[model samples]
Target: MAVLLVGTVVVLPSPQSTLAAWTATEYGRGSLQAGTVNPPTNLQCSAGVLTPPTFTWTLPAAGGLTRTGFTWSLSGGFTGGGTLGATATSVTVPGGLLGIGSGTFRLVANGPGGWTSTPVTGTLGMLTAILYSCSVP
Candidate 1:
């Protein structure tokens, strides 16, 4: 008479590692609040043209995440500015931008993974043209 016994067990599946330990962290690292650039911030032009402006800002609270892209600039002659189109939270003033007299305009608000907030400047008025004459003609 004879008898025999055997036992075996194996399990392995985990060899695709290239340095990974950060699941997803981005609580607070992007800030750019209170970026105002409304009508008549400090604009007073004449003969050159610049009196009809409107640019406002005050939506930089991406703590919850909801700002895809936003960039703007208006210094001097103003040439199309920069990066001012994409999930726009607020963007106007693209009608020739007046005759351009004063300069100073900026805004930045981009959230998610990359995060980016902190750049708000205003004060660019250039659009004055008010000539009305009607003496009972």
Candidate 2:
């Protein structure tokens, strides 16, 4: 007669299980659902043919939660740029803050849930150079 031993495997819930557990713990019966901050729309920029440029956009609606603030970022040709706090439906970012020439700007709305899942981004002035270039015949 011969005897054999076998190994058993156990499966565990994924990380997302925490969310479900948290929801149950927080909400009691149902699962907790995370919310998203809406990004500003109607983004536009002034003519950047001159030093610095202006940026404008429509404020995002906060569904039902309170929005804490807005974060604006500028990359390329600028240094040490800052963020702005907003409580208005429309905002116009002056040229001085945007720096000179062209660059990329991203807008994020912050709230209780978190910042916008996907930020809204745009370019100032014009696309000066291509980030990458390849040649093939």
Candidate 3:
């Protein structure tokens, strides 16, 4: 009589398989999980109605994985500053481009994964116009 011993072999998942499973869970066939970015806060303008004033604000945190860029505008109108990468937390508005008088500047951050938050509005003072003029006879 001959006796044979059988051992059980266990197979571990490959890195690719593990990654694929993670991908399927995180980003299934339906859609990828994305995050919305918070609007910039604590807006501030330098010099008050000064030309080439610097605008600063606290950087917003991403609601999910990551945020892509920030869009700046004036009174809901897009400014020439264009889209800024996530690294940027502030931007300077040229006096000429800002025009004259008082206006509201808005900012909203967006993520590449399809997320855009409500825009935050901030007021800026411009010294462009003369408040009053006097004439002597």
User: What digit string (tens of lDDT, one per residue) describes model 3 on residues 3-86?
Assistant: 999999999976663333333445345655545567766666555423355667787754554667888776523245567888
Off by over 4 Å in 3: 1-34, 48-50, 76-81, 129-137
The true-versus-predicted C-alpha distance at residue 10 of model 2, in Å, is: 42
Give the clashing pairs for model 3: none
lDDT of 2 by residue, 1-137 (tens): 99999999999976653443433444356686766777777766544343244456777765734577777776766433445676644334445544335556666777775554357766653333322111111
Question: Best candidate, TM-score-wise?
Answer: 3
Give, for candidate 3, the lowest lDDT window spanning 10 residues.
128-137
TM-score, candidate 3, is 0.58
lDDT of 1 at 108: 66
**How good is model 1 by TM-score?**
0.24
Give each model a TM-score.
0.24, 0.52, 0.58
lDDT of 3: 0.61
- Superposed by TM-score, candidate 3 places the C-alpha of residue 12 at a distance from the truth, in angstroms, of 69
